[model samples]
Target: MPPANGAWAWLAPGNSWGWSNAGLISDGEESLLVDTLYDLELTDEMLAKMRDAEPLANNIDTLVNTHANGDHCHGNELVCGAEIIASSASAAEMAELPPEAMAAIVAMAPDMGEMGRYFLDCFGQFKFEGITFTPPTKTFEGELHLQVGDKPVELIEVGPAHTRGDILVHSPKDRVVYTGDILFIEGTPIIWEGPVNNWTEACRRIEAMDVDHIVPGHGPITDKHGVAAVRQYLEFVHEQARQRYDAGMSAFDAAKDIELAEYSAWSDPERIAVNVDSLYREFRGEQAASDVFELFARMAALAGYDVATP
Candidate 1:
């Protein structure tokens, strides 16, 4: 559904894995797409919806990827004709893991033990094959201003939090902000890049905006209240992770030991493992990258997989 100003949010179901949201700003003749979905089929479905809602969307004039995550940008190939824009950091990160990686992971899922089964459960619905990595044609550093027909849109880079190049797409005319992964609604947000503080600050920035509708990269459409929810979760996890860090606990141990309490009900609660790992690295002033397989194993353990006995 579109807000009063022709800004539409394509929301996927909550509590489901790889279910992300996309946004569209139409001016009756041209449409600007905020982000694409995880797979070709999903993207096609979204585009079809947009076309039905606003014929202008049939000719997407511009596309902005809020971040580098495949769930947000994997369908770029489907919109290859549009002029793609992203932060330079995100453009760089986009090439680091292409669709081929997703294909390989799916191909090996059958033999990955419990982790494999869990991986399939999360992503098995998406088709990873035949996706071509299409990097952004243009990149910016801090801010960019453009127009979707007559509606002015501002792009603000707020990353090294959700991902290296996370951004917020704000349309002042529409009073909507498309927060790519920077706000994950009711879901437990995964921190691939964080000092935790940065993520929290990003939420505050969104709160500072004069917007009525917020389209999150994942989950339902929301407002500042949604931003606050994500901020609270980040702060809660940061404090918990810090307590464990002070006790010299391993990231995995801290993740396992921390009590989720109010956040336990969020979707993908095992993402606490990734959040804790990122927080531990921040606490130690170490590099933020970790082996993906090891992180998944840790998450699997926290989610009830016992690798030692399996």
Candidate 2:
């Protein structure tokens, strides 16, 4: 839904994982794309929708990737002409996992046994090939200001939480804030990076802002309440993980034992495994350096996936 002003969002509905949300802010002549989608086909569809709204969207002058995650920046090759921008940290993280990495994952899925099957189920449709890694040509640290013609847009870096560098696109003129994975509605948020406190504070920052429509990285168009809901989930999970840590339980055991009946209705409940593991590390004042594949393997096990016999 397009906001009250020139702000617009492309929300991919349902609980299908990796179906992230993107936004556009156009003022007739110039436009800014909040983020791209997970793959070539998805990004093409989103660009088509945006073009339908305004032809200016077809030639977006600036592309702001909220974070380095492939889902947010993978389709950047499609808009190579635009000057891409991101937080300095995000630009660094962008290089950490390239399109080839995704391609490798897809190829290895079959051999991964049950875990591989679940991996394909979550991310098989994405066409990772032909995705050129277009790192942000311009980067900023904390805040940056820009304009979609006359409407003002503010980019706020709020990370070392969702990822090494997550950001929010705030349209003060439209009273809208496009949070890139900082808030997820109707879905469990995987904590790829966290101090837990940084994430909760990020949510609180949004709560204090005088904004109307809140555009989350995934799920439906929301408001301040949606932001609060995500924050509450994170807080609850943090406490649960903390108790398990105090008892010296493994991340997998703690995740399996913790009851998320309250968030049971949310999609991708297996993400609790990742969230608990992340919070446990944070609780112990440890470095945020968990192995990605190891985390996924643990999640697959917790989700009742049976490993194939050798």
> Per-prediction count of colliding residue pairs?
0, 0
In candidate 1, the residue pairs with backbone N, CA or C atoms under 3 Å apart (3 or more residues apart, or in different chains) clash, namely none
- The residue pairs that clash in candidate 2, if any, are none
lDDT of 2 by residue, 1-310 (tens): 6875788988986545678999998885998999998888899988988889778887899999999989999999888589899999999999999988999899899998888988998888788887877789999999999988889889999998989999999998889999999988988888988978889999999999898899999999888888999999999999999888999998888998999987888888888988998888887788857887887777777667874311
Task: Please provide, for model 1 over 151-184, each residue's C-alpha lDDT reduced to its tens digit, 9 standing for 90 to 100.
Answer: 8899999888988989999999999999999888
Q: lDDT of each model, Cα atoms only?
A: 0.87, 0.88
Task: Give all TM-scores, in the order shown.
Answer: 0.97, 0.96
lDDT of 2: 0.88
